[model samples]
Target: MTRSAPVPAPAVREMDIDGEVTLFHEPTQTALVLNETAGDVWRLVDGERTADDIVRLLASSYGAGPDDVRGGVEAALAQLAAHHVVDLPSPG
Candidate 1:
């Protein structure tokens, strides 16, 4: 079984273009722009919370049903992981 590694706090810097926002990370040159809901979810990744916990939080906070938030969070995390902005949790 794969073990989940502790998620680390992202080193983030943001820029506002007119009314739009984009987050930039120097290490991976990954630029992430969050829509309103995704932005809310993004704020919860404070290094202390696991990905599973994040999904749970999002479900409650956003009034989203469990399945939707779980799917969305997992997809977002996968994307972030691909960009090296966040680490993925292993099955263990």
Candidate 2:
């Protein structure tokens, strides 16, 4: 079984307030309070980018290695998936 790419769920939307990006889930009536890294990840979830792409993008932005970035992104994605704020692909 292969997992597909992840993207923001339909009920979620992004907003920038005072230079910070925030993601809100309409149905859940919840807003994710994100750090800069999480905000970047939220913005990058456009239904196309893979997890590796996210790690690479953020890694380059922070001038850090991809290992830690990959772990963080994976954790964030898992949390988002648990909240149903992101659409995790079903395994085949």
Candidate 3:
């Protein structure tokens, strides 16, 4: 079963500064800070790319192994989901 790609929440306002991202979730009134890598992953969340795609993207860009990239991306995505900065849909 393939999982749906994560989609960034529409109500988020973001600021990119010095390779980090600051996201403000309007509805929850929460502010989140993501590091350079997480910010890169966030930029790719257009509801079109799956978690595997995110891992590959980061791995290729950083010359890192897929194993190394996957965990960080997943962790960042989890954090984003927890904070309501992004939406993670379950597979049916």
The whole-model lDDT of each prediction reads: 0.68, 0.82, 0.89
lDDT of 3 by residue, 47-90 (tens): 99998998998899999999988988999899899999999868
Model 1 agreement with the true structure over 1-92: per-residue lDDT tens digits: 55354353367676776655567878767788866655655666666677778888889887887788887887776666665666666664
- Which candidate order results from sorting by TM-score in descending order? 3, 2, 1
Best model number under lDDT: 3
In Å, residue 54's CA in model 1 sits off its true spot by 1.1
Worst 10 residues of 1 by lDDT: 1-10
Q: Which ten residues in a row are the worst by lDDT in model 3? A: 13-22
Count clashing residue pairs in model 1: 1
Error of 1 at 63 (Å): 1.6
Off by over 4 Å in 2: 1-3
TM-scores, one per candidate: 0.69, 0.83, 0.88
Better of 1 and 3 by lDDT: 3
lDDT of 2 at 30: 87
- How does model 2 fare in lDDT? 0.82
Tens digits of per-residue lDDT for model 2 on 1-80? 55567878898877887888777889989887677777778778877888888889999998999996888898888888
Return the clash pairs for model 2, or none: none
